[model samples]
Target: MTLYYAPRTVSAAVAIALNEVGAPYETVKIDFASSDQTKPGYHKVNPKGRVPALITDRGVLTETSALLDYVAALYPKARLVPDDPFQAAQMRSVMTYLASTWHINHAMGGRGARWAYQQSSFDDLKSKVTENITANCRYFEDEVVQGPFVLGNQFTLADAYFYTVTTWLPSDGVDIADFPHLHAYQQRMQARASVQKAQSDGFF
Candidate 1:
């Protein structure tokens, strides 16, 4: 497997999951700073022109949630997903929220151009990031996170996904310290070997 990723992006979640499963893979850095993801060469790899495209033996896989699920399925012994159906659905629900809601909220701060053409509109979107992301953090604190992990006690793929998104909190103008549960969750996730490996590898 070969993982194409950009630092400080949600792509880090996939790298952490691969490491958690002890999967052997090489990483190709997609330098978003240089517009590498938009180049034709990369477009051939992923027509969406985005990072976190994984080249597996079967085919290329994009999207963080799908890739995480693939990794968990490939290495069931890693138990990156819950065995119970309801718990598994709960895990997917959180991952979906991260991808569809929380991440979009954060993107508006910097990627506002994707949504609007007007400068004033960009500013409006940027202004809302702090409030939107803080609300997301609050939701995770009061409703989402069950305990030590997203599902409590057991470390699953959702942790990798949640941890990566949470890393954006400080830059999104929200302090992790404002949410004790999430702050502690961040600390615990940082201590994990998979996360340490992802960080050391420059996945962020």
Candidate 2:
């Protein structure tokens, strides 16, 4: 398996999941700083031109949630997803929300061009990034984070997914310290070997 990723991005979550699964894979760095992801070479791997594209014997997989779940499915022993139907649904729900909402809020802090073409419009959107991310952080602090992880003691793919977004909060003008549960959750996540490995390898 080969994972295409960029540093300090959600792509690191896939690497962490692969580590958790004890999967050996090669890393292909797509340096977004140089616009590498937009090049034609990478388009062959992911037309969407995003990070966390996984190339396996079967095929290339894009999208953070898909690749994360794929790793979990490939190695069931990792138990990245729950076995019970309801629990599994809950896990997916959180991951989906992260992709659909939290991640979007994080992206607004920098990638405004993905949404707006006009420079003034892009600036307006970018200006709201910190506020939007703060709102999302408040939601997670008050409603989402359940316990030690997204699903209490169980560490699922959702935790990995959510952890990636929390990394953006400080830059998004969110005082993580204000959210006691989330702050503690971040500490616990940082202590995980998988996360530590991903951070070290990702140069973050």
Candidate 3:
């Protein structure tokens, strides 16, 4: 498998999952800094022109949640997902929230161009990022996070997904220190070997 990713983006979640599964895969860096993702060459890999596109023997996969799910499915022995159906659904709920809500909020800060045409509108979206993301942080702290991990004790794919989103908090102007549980959760995730390996491999 070959994973196309950009550093400091949600793509790191996929890398972390792949590492957790001990999967043998190579990474191809998509340099967002140079607008590499927008080029026609990358569009062939992911027409969406985004990072985190994985090339498997079957085909290419995109979207953070889908790729994470695929990795977990390919290596069930890694137990990245819960065996219980209800628990698995709960994990999906969190991952969905991260992709649909939390990540959108963070993107508004720098990716306002995707949503608005006017400069003022862009500023408006950027201004709301901190408040929106902080609210998300609060939700995770009080409701979503079950302790030690998102599902309590057993580390699920949601942990990798959530950890990737939390990485944008400080840059989004929301201090992680303000949310103690999430702050600790980030610390716990950082201590994991998968996360460490991802960082070492420059998937960060």
TM-score, every prediction: 0.99, 0.96, 0.98
Candidate 2 segments exceeding 4 Å error: none
What's the candidate order when arranged by decreasing lDDT? 1, 3, 2
lDDT of 3 by residue, 110-153 (tens): 99999889999999999999899888988889999988999998
Tell me how candidate 1 scores on lDDT. 0.95
Q: Which stretches of candidate 1 lie over 4 Å from their true place?
A: none
State model 3's lDDT. 0.93
Q: Write the residue-wise lDDT of candidate 2 on 2-70 in tens digits.
A: 999988888888988998889999999998889999999999999999888999999999999999999
Error of 3 at 52 (Å): 0.7
At residue 179, candidate 1 shows an lDDT of 97
- lDDT of candidate 1 over 1-204, digit per residue (tens): 999999999999999999999999999998888999999999999999987999999999999999999999999999999999999999999999999999999999998989999999999999999999999999999999987999998999999999999999888999999999999999999999999999999987
Better of 1 and 2 by TM-score: 1
The lDDT per prediction is 0.95, 0.88, 0.93
lDDT score of residue 56 within candidate 1: 95
Write the candidate numbers in order of decreasing TM-score: 1, 3, 2
